[model samples]
Target chain A: MSTFLLILITGIGLGALYFLVASGLSLIYGLMGVLNFAHGAFLTIGAFTGLWIATKVFPNPTTWTFIFSMFAGGIAAGLFALLMEQLVITRLYNRHIDQALVTVGVSLVVTALLGGWFGFDARFLPTPLWFTKAATIGDAIIPVDRFIYIGVAAILLIAMLSILKFTRIGLIIRAGVENRSMVTALGINVRLAFSTVFFIGGFAAGVGGVLISVFSYGVSPLMGGSWLIYGFIVVVVGGMGSIAGSAIAAMLIGITNQFANYYVTGLGDFVVVIILAAVLLTKPTGLLGKVSH
Target chain B: MLRWKYSRPLLIAITVIFAILPFAGDNPLSKAGLQQTMAVAFLFGALALTYDLLFGFTGLLSFGHALYFASGMYVTAILINDFNVNFLLAILIAVIFTSLLAVLTGGAALRTTGITFAMVTLAFGQAGHVVIARDFGGFTNGDDGLPVNADRLPDFFIGVVNTKYLYLLALGILVFIYFTAWWITESSAGRVFAALRDNEQRVSVLGLNPNRFKLLSFVLSAAMAALIGAAMLIVSGSGSPRYAAADITIALLLMVILGGPVTRWGAVLGGIIYSVLSTRLTVLSDGTAFDSLPNFIGGPLAEPAFTLGLIFILIVMFAPGGISGAYYRARFKYLNKGK
Candidate 1:
């Protein structure tokens, strides 16, 4: 029973990370009709930048320093994403296929550049001591980092939901996701929304990157690629444009992965693939997906 | 620009030149080192041609092609090494198995079009990669990789002295694949494929099931990729987990785009050029030439992927039609000038 509880909590932590990456992917695909291959690059950049700050600026980081590094990572990644939109993605506006291809190119170049710069090895980040501590709840002793992940993820989710619910940009984005042509016809400058969506997605991915580094205790050039695949799966399973759907799907996949890995050894990844296939075959539109294309 | 009357002769001439390249005297072409490189180039060229059949002709942008290729490589290697099967029979069995696998996966993936299809295929491909890396049932041997057993009854295929046979074999595979792609593209089914690419709804209106044609193209492309995989195992003498990576499919995409999609030879050209550049760049990176340059500038230049990826982005931005598109444009302008 204790083991089950531990696995369940751990899986939620994993799911939290997935939601961070998937939220951005879902929003971008919803608004722009692009599968951003460079999203992984954004995550990688965030992770490396966070590492740089923790190691260089604050060799012995306090809680405040650590939080600052995380935000710094997110902001850097967000700016990079904005530049990508203004420079590369904007030029091929309306050409969804070319946009995807260019993103793929960007991902390759960024990953290669990171590998060249970082020497392709995993570098452990400096964390606050409390992050390494554990909390005892009943018979289940949970690592404090899991709570931090869950906490940060919950805050971000609420923040995003509120932004979507109340803001002007949020209204435009919601309408744009429904009918991009209609939104344009309404004269609301959908292009600005496009850049905004990319920035938000990049910021989420960057934060996710920092959290992932904390979870794994290190950062590597190729780390983002693996997580990005899961993010893609979550986006598809959760529906293309739905945040609530993504959160639910993320938890489902994460818990399933943990249980499968525990019960059958090397079957965790295989089971996740099975789930994806099942979902795709049964409901191609995903759990809450409205768009048929 | 060569007229239609001369294009056929020019093609034959090019083929003859490649066929006889191994005997071109003491230059780089005649050496064993270069022969191996060219053989790899030919293998990729064939693989790219198969990819072209899907993306260029049929408009299916699949991202999991490496799954089939890796299946062919690993299956053949396992059969030969573990079961002690003959190399030829192993390859034959691997091809058959991969075709069935392709049918199953392709059937499922073809249910979605465009980006969804790409993602579905990617999931399947990643599944294959994981399975291989995990060493399921101890068949794949995990990340250490599986090397081909040379004693399994093929003399000409083994040893450095007989690199020419491997070279010729690669050339033969490339030629066979080229003609097969050509035949398929020129057939009535190929016409339907072109139509499907342009407009799937119209193809359905014409009373042909677009899904079936797409499945056909998918299976054919996958099976051919598997064959290339088998050939690659023989050429390189081993199979590694990298064969199943998503990056391989991306590289194939790069080749198709670089050579100019829709034109079969353009894919082949892209494949050849990419393979050569990738191999040579590694050698260049390891050399002392970059030692004198600044770290920031030299570091990126040392990685071939950076340069290739930059070029890929530029091409997608500027030259949507690739090298073949450029050639066609120049030819059109020259002919109009003559008038």
Candidate 2:
């Protein structure tokens, strides 16, 4: 029973990380109608940036310094994404297939740059002193870092949902996603809304990267490629352009992967991929996705 | 097979060039390394040609075509190595098996279009990589790759050595694939594929099921890809897990783009040039001349794949139609001036 509780917590922690990543991807896909393959590269960039700051810029960094590093990472990713949007993606709007190919090219370039800059070896991030302890909940003991990740993810999720549901910008975004030309016709600056959404998406991916790096203790150039695949799976299974669906799908995949890892060992990644394919076969629209066409 | 009048002569010229390439190694016409490079290029040409059928002609951008290729190689390798199956029979089985796999996956994948289909296929490709690396490691030998014993292979196979005979075999298969692709494009069904590529909704409205033609193209493409895989195995004498991953698919995508999609001869030319240039570029990147450059500038440039990525972006951004399109436009302008 205690092991079950532990597994559940572990799954939720994993899910929270995925939720942070996939939600951003979902939002971008919803509004821009572009599958940003470089989303994972942003995560890698964020984590690496945070690590670089914590170690190189701030010697013997405290918990507060680490948090600041995370923010810097997110900001860096956001700026990079803004540039990508203004330069490359803006030209390829409405051409989804071409957009896919170009984004993949962007991803490769970013990944290669990271590899060249940082070298290919995976490096561990210096853990904040405060996160090294374990927290006991009921009869189950959980790492404090895991709990912190879940807490942070929950706060971000609430913030995103409230923004989307309550704010004028959120309404505009929702409307723009549904009918960009219609929104443009109605005199709403759909382009600005998309840019804002793209920035936020990049920001979320960066934060997710920081969080995952905090837990995993390192980052590599290739790390983003694997996560990008999983992020695609989550968004697809949850339903494209649906944040709620993506979150649910992320949790399901995260949990399944944990269980599969515990029981089946090496087949964990394979099982999740198979599940994604099965979901795609059975539910083309995804679990919570509205019929796109 | 459909003959696009102008390309017929070009195809014959390419065939003749490849036919003579192995013999030209000792002469000033070709370098010693040319034969091996062309052999691998022909295999890649076959792979790109099949991909062209799907993406360029049929309007289906599949990201998991590498899975079919790897499946073909592995099945044949396992049959010949482990089960002592006859080489010819194994090749036949590999083709049939991969096409059937393609049919099954394509049936499901065709339900989605554009990026959704690409992602679904990506998932399959990733899954295939994992399966080869882990689940079926016993047969695949995981990342180390499963090698075919030299003695087990028939007298025809070079068994890991890139030889004149292997080059001939690859060239022969490539010719077959080129002709097959050309014929498909010339067929009425091929016309339907072209129509589907232009506008699927309009074709469906005309009472033609786009999915049926998509499936046929998918199966045909997969069969050709698998044959290339078989040819690769015969040349390299091993099947590696990399064959089942997205890298090969992306490389083929790059080649197709370079050649210009929807142009069969362009894809072949793209494969040959990319294959040759990549090897040369890798050498240049690692050579002494690049060493004198500053670290920041030289670092990324030292990797040919990074340069390829840059070129891919440039092509997608500035010149979507690629070399073939440029040539056609120039020729058309010249002919118009003459008129």
Which numbered prediction scores highest in TM-score against the true structure? Answer: 1
Give the Cα-based TM-score of candidate 1 against the true structure. Answer: 0.98
lDDT of 2 by residue, A1-293 (tens): 77777777888888888988898888888887788888988888788888888889986878788878888888888888888889988898777767777877888888877776777788878866878888788888877887877787788788888988999999998887677778889898888887888788888888888888877778888877878878888988998777888879988998888888888677779889898888888888789986363
Candidate 2 — which residues are off by over 4 angstroms? A291-293, B1-7, B25-34, B159-162
DockQ of 1: 0.73
What DockQ do the predictions score, one after another?
0.73, 0.66
Query: After best superposition, candidate 2 residue A25: deviation in angstroms?
Result: 1.4
RMSD of each: 1.4, 2.4
| Model 2 complex DockQ against the native | 0.66
TM-score of chain B of 1: 0.97
The interface root-mean-square deviations, each candidate in sequence, come to 1.1, 1.5
Model 2, C-alpha of A123: deviation from truth (Å): 2.0
Q: Please, what are the lDDT tens digits per residue for candidate 1 over residues B226-277?
A: 8899999999999998999888999999999888999898899999999999
Q: After superposition, how far is residue A33 of candidate 1 from its true place, in Å?
A: 0.3
